[model samples]
Target: MNKNLIIGQFTDAYLPITDGVVLTVKNYAHWIEKKYGKCIVICPSFPKFIDEDNFDIIRFFSIPMPLRPPYRMGIHYLDLKAIKRVEKIPFHIVHAHSPFSAGLFALETARKRKVPIVATFHTKYYDDFKSATKSDFLARIGVDIIVKFYEKVDQVWTVNSSTAKTLKEYGFKKEIEIIPNGTDIIPPENLEEYKEKINKIYNLSQDDNVFLYVGQLILHKNIKMLIESLYYLKMKGFSFKFLIVGTGKDEKYLKDLVRKLKLDKEVIFVGRIIDRELLKGFYARADLFLFPSLYDASPLVLQEAFALSCPSLLIKGSNASEGIIDGYNGFLSENNAISYANMIEKLIKNKPLLREVGKNAQKTLYRPWEKVIDEVVERYKELIFTYKKNF
Candidate 1:
């Protein structure tokens, strides 16, 4: 164990925003600081949002991105005070969670300090660029820039092998490391107590089938298809309560679609819950975790749901569905609303099978943050040693 290990985690999202990458960065900092050594989180500032964390955080100047609600574009160079504070820390190695502003800052800091820097390729940026710009040429240019950024880093990492394939498709030919994200949720001994609490809070009855989707409410996540699937399920006389957790830019559009599809009674948009305990309770109560994201590279929510013995339904070929064995540990569906609806109906019909699958999911997918960070710390040490030897 390195008692003097000092880490710097640079990310575009933090505290106020809840997403896969944000959760990954939070867990990395939390575990690293708790068991390893000191860690400093450098992220964009959210207006009037006071960070309440045990570890240190450096909030740089930023403005909210209009296209993506609650996600701010950080301008670290503009914050001279924050830069001075960052310069004072003797960081052993720096890790970047995004290739945007915060990542650029990490690259600069690593070069200035002459330390190893690791950048994790988490999102499908090309899809994001195409969705934002509506131009293939522009999206390609953006991807090229992203590849160049990863090339400069000491090491490149992805949450899974599927995501590494995506990075290679985008022109990053370097050897990529696979370090999966972790969850802190542990199944409670008295799970029914938490489930009962969730039932009362959500006005759900024990007999009603409960489906959950916990992540950003965006179109790219195929939330529209999830709602559409509910419509088909409702038409077949299947009574289920679908809880849509978290908020995003597409929330309003999704709500409007739900109303238009006459699924307002079946689907409930439960906005973002920052309380981890309450969130875990929802996972415990859910009969199935419904996630059909085509854009997510590696979803942290899937692991969080699996941690509480909740099986997830993901798209068959999606990057997040890499480890899942359809119907054995988790369920899979084609990229269509009817397939999702049919899959949901099939799973709910067999309660014993569903429960067994949930147990299997927990056994196979749940990886604690402590163990993950132990591996991360070892990797950091190896990177630092290799860099020093070559220097």
Candidate 2:
């Protein structure tokens, strides 16, 4: 709790993207500045997107990433203007959310300042590389670079134990600290009001079963499996409404698949919502959240849904489903469409079970950013103390 501690948060992702890592870094910057000390966010610039946070944001030069739309590749070293601006800030300890250009810049800054640096491993990088490059050899090389980056950092962190294990699998042999992601939302008091509003907007009724998925519409997130499972659910003569609330690289392919499966009427894509309250309304309206992603190490959307008392049905044994218990706080199904469909069919009919599980999810899963950042700043303090003593 050093009020004079000025922290640097470096990342490749930021505003207008709305992914988990961006949200994580944003919350970290927000809460740290509010309660502890000054925090500056350093990330790649998104064209025409003005940052309006209480804390300062320093954006560097960037170019659009072809494979990942809306996310730019930062060329931090080339941005002399940004470099000169950041040079004046007195950063005590720096944190990197990505090992790309922004992270390297953070590493350089930490070295120049003679301060400890922390790097958080947040994603399954191998999957991302293989998806973009379509080569296992290239993917392995990418993971090797990721491991080398973590090895260079003063401290390494992951969102959960499963994520730590993932880093270990990727050949990082160092110790990792677990700092779980937190949601900014809480259970809405007027849940019924939001549910009614969503029902009217989407042409749904009180009795109709509504399921939701609010993330990138990409194959890597196993969105294909979700669409196929819904096709099976329809084939089994069930009536339901599905709302997919995000856009991604595979949006066209996923939409085409839904058309091929004749699920056009049942599935609705509410693309890229920025309003948290509006998103919460969708969560409030959902009977269950369907997220079967094996790609995500730990998804913030899952916790967001749970905060609104909406339970999720995740893939059995998947990393995102690590802390979930089947048929208790949440539901789990086998990785295939048939098994997922079968589980959905059973749950859609039992209203009592759905309500009970949703309540349990709210109790077990919702951890607010305020509580999570208290722990984070304390860790920052410890790292600073130990690092300075040793130095």
Candidate 3:
């Protein structure tokens, strides 16, 4: 809560383009200003997106990625213009939310200012790159870039041990602190009304079992397997509403898969829901959260689901499924469509068990943002003091 400690955080994405990385930067920036000192957010500038918060922000010019239009890539260089802008902010620490373009900018500023830098390994870039390009060679290049990016940082943090192991496997030798992402949402006061709204809009009866997947509609999230699982369910004559929220580069591919599988009636692609109340409403309407991503490190979606008492159904040993006990907080399946189909079919039959597990999921939501961000800020404090002492 020291006002003297100024921090500059860098991220590649922000609002109007929601993901874990963007949400992480926003939440930390918002809470850091509320408690610690001022936190300045440096992100890519997109057209028509204005600075809409009380926090300090510096946006650099960025353009939409050709392959992935939803993503805006920063075009900042370490020239006089970049240096001039970074020099304006007197920050004690430089925190990079990603290890890409904005991260490189943060590294440059930290090097120029002789300040400590920290980075959070938010995603499995190898999988992300592979999904984007469908090329292992490019994914290897991405792994190399990630390795080199973290080499210059003073401290590294992540959300789970599986991802920490993945980082080590990718040639990063530094120690990584595992700070699980927190979920902070004020549940809609009228939950039943929200449910009714969603049911009416989606053309579903209140008796239908709603299964939800609430993140990017991409390959690495195992969305293809989810779609296949739905096909298997339909074959078995199961009746349920599968809600596909959020959009990504693979929207067309996933949609085509749904059509090919003839799941047009069961699956509903709601696109990206930016409104928090509507999002929370969809979360409340669902009976289960179906997420079976193998390449993740404690996805915030799981926490969001848990916060709303919506138990997640994920694959065993998947990073996002960590801490989720099978049949307790969530149901764990194998890395196959048949297994997911079996789990969904079984859970659909036992509605009482679904509610019971959902109740158990709430047990994992007691950790407040106040505690999570305190640990994060404490690390910033330690890294800064250590940097000053060593220098």
Q: Per-prediction TM-score, please? A: 0.98, 0.99, 0.94
**Quality of model 2 by C-alpha lDDT:** 0.92
**Model 2: colliding residue pairs:** none
Give the C-alpha miss distance for residue 170 in model 2, angstroms. Answer: 0.7
Which portions of model 3 show Cα errors greater than 4 Å? 78-82, 132-134, 187-190, 365-367
Local accuracy of candidate 3 as per-residue lDDT tens digits, 1-391: 2666789989989876788888888889888998888988888888987788779888887878887777889877733565577788878999998898889999989988999999989888887788778899989988998899998899898887888888998899878888878877744457789788888888888899899999987777889998999899999988888999998888999999999999998899998887777887787889888998887787777777776777779999877777878887789999999999999999888878888898788776434566788898888888888999999
Clashing pairs in 1: none
lDDT of 2 by residue, 99-218 (tens): 999999999899988999999999999999998899999999999998999999999999999989999999989899999999998778999988988988898989889999999888
- Model 1 Cα RMSD, 1 decimal: 1.1
Off by over 4 Å in 2: none
- On lDDT, the stronger of 2 and 3 is 2
Against the true structure, whose TM-score is highest? Answer: 2
What lDDT score belongs to each candidate, Candidate 1 first? Answer: 0.91, 0.92, 0.84
Clashes of each: 0, 0, 0
Better of 1 and 3 by lDDT: 1
Task: List RMSD in Å for every model shown.
Answer: 1.1, 0.9, 1.9
